[model samples]
Target: MSHSPAPRRRIPAPRPADGFMLLLEAARDLRTVGAVAPSGKALARALTEPVRAQAGQPLDILEAGAGTGAVTRTLIPQLAPGSRLDVAEANPRFAHRLSELVRAHPHLAGRPPEQVRVHDVHVERLETGRRYDVIVSGLPFTNFSPHHVEAIMDRYLELLRPGGTLTYFAYRGTGRARALLASPAQAHRHRAVERLLAAYRDRCATGRRTAWANLPPATVWQLRRPAYAVEHSGTRAATAEGAGGAGGVPGPAGVPRTGL
Candidate 1:
């Protein structure tokens, strides 16, 4: 009689340290890091739903504020052949880790080196000439000032191609919490940001979903750029102010204007 050997269980790559890193970064700057823990699996899934919806087609994706690459891990596996991903992380440490992850991702091993690129720069400052088909944002809009939020949102629209989708998440109860526990100035700022975002939502939002499984429940909002090119004077005013009069919605020269 012959004895059969047991099958070995595969061990996942080490990721236990991401939580600690997130905490450290949050402590250093809560405005940028926002949450103390990395995003949960459910949240990542909700934020990447647009990409999954466009499965089987090559897509260009941009992931902003990719702290610890939690969502990046989710985005990479779903990339179709010939697709490209550009990850932007403002934090140097997080950007370094993201670069390493992009390099080591198994799914990208056989793909061209340019298939994935990690940029250590703020998403607003990122100046890639190419537009994206999907933009997944992990930035904490609630933590930022109204001006910054408007600037970032404008930049996202500028980076997206017409008919492109943008997905982002906001933690639940944050507005209420700020109203109760934050200073008057903070609360006012939050309210201003809310109003600004509400305008964008009214103009472009397609759908929204809640991810209850996340550490702090979050609502993911999906906005689609209009398929046709049209101009909006209100958007032009907001974009000009957000860009500090540096001309409207700066991008690669000759990029067609897709007014929000």
Candidate 2:
């Protein structure tokens, strides 16, 4: 008699020391690293919802501030063939970790190396000329100065193709905590950043969702770039590039070019 074959066990994504690394990074630089823990699976799902919604289409995706590859792991499995993902993490150590994740990601097996790349640079500084269909941001906007926050938001919108979506999350209760524990100056700065963000939300917000299962809970906001802006920006970028302006900055030494 022929014996029945057993099913293959699914191999889980590599997640060694993610939480510990996040905590250490946070302790070393809370302003940049932002969170004390890696983002939970629920939050990752919420952030990658746009990608899922656009399933089967080859897309250009950008992930800013990918910390410890929490969302990256969730994203890799969802990428359709011919889709490209560019991960920008300003933290060098985090960028290195993300590179490792991209290499070991089971879903990325047999794919070209150019399909996904980790850039050790700030999203605003990423000079890739390609615009994205979806942009997922894991940056801590609340911790930045108002000017910095505005710059990053501007960069995000510029990097998105017309009608493209950008998803980002902010932990719940942060405003209350800032008001209660922060000094007057810090609280004032936080309020300023909020107002700046509020203006953008008022203009471009497409949807909002809350991830309660995440550590400390979080709210994910989705914004779409106005289709009209693309034509104008494209003209300006072309002009700048034609004039040999600083529209594109060179990547740092030892950093691989994304070639997007």
Candidate 3:
């Protein structure tokens, strides 16, 4: 009697470093690495909504502070053909790993690897000449000083094309934790960043989403730059319509042990 043939199995996607890499990087620098675990699937989806919404268009996208390609996985598949993605990570290891992930990503099969670039630099230092239609940021804003966050935010807005959308997340309930676990001075720094973020949220925020399924949970905000945004080389001008600051923390301030 002839035995039945075994069924074929499909190849699966390669798993990137994910939590392991993020944890290692965090150990190196909690302030820069931020979280202990990589972003959850739910959180990744929430953070990438702007890129999803722009599907079918040849868009220019930027993913800042991408850690282990968590959100990058969700994003690359949604990019319309001919679209390009630039990833900025402050950690050299993460950046190198991200480059490898991008090279092997199935979504990039049809296009050259040049479509995706990983930059080992802080988001603020990325080249300014190129503007993006959508930006998904994974930076840990709460860990940073207000001035730095503001500068980064300004750079993000500056890099956006008119009417572009920016999406970013902060772990929920981090403020209270900071107040309890940190020195008064450190706590004060945390508070300052919160206030700065609040200012931005108040002005330009279009909407927010909560991802309770994540390791420490998170809130994603979508902010828009005014369609008519125009910057003169030198001028003391106010921001344009729909192009203001973002909103404040939605709930309890949290200092989460989660990674970007």
TM-score of each: 0.86, 0.84, 0.82
Better of 1 and 3 by TM-score: 1
Off by over 4 Å in 3: 1-17, 230-260
Candidate 2 regions exceeding 4 Å error are: 1-16, 230-260
lDDT of each: 0.83, 0.81, 0.77
Instruction: Please provide, for model 2 over 148-182, each residue's C-alpha lDDT reduced to its tens digit, 9 standing for 90 to 100.
Output: 67668878887888889999999999999999998
Q: Write the per-residue lDDT of candidate 3 for residues 1-260, one digit (tens) a residue.
A: 99998654332243655677788888888988888988889999999888777679898999999988888888888878888899998888888878877876767775877788889998888984688999999999888765577678878878888788999998988888987898766777677677667766776789999999998999999988767643323322122112222223222122110111
lDDT of 1 by residue, 50-130 (tens): 999999899999999999988999998998998999999999999999888887787876689999999999998998899
The numbered model that scores best in TM-score is 1
State, as a TM-score between 0 and 1, how close model 3 is to the true structure: 0.82
C-alpha RMSD (angstroms) for model 2 = 8.9
Report the candidate with higher lDDT, 2 versus 3: 2
**True-vs-predicted CA distance for residue 72, candidate 2, Å:** 0.4
Q: Which of the predicted structures, 1 or 3, would earn the higher lDDT when compared with the native?
A: 1
Cα deviation of 170, candidate 1, in Å: 0.4
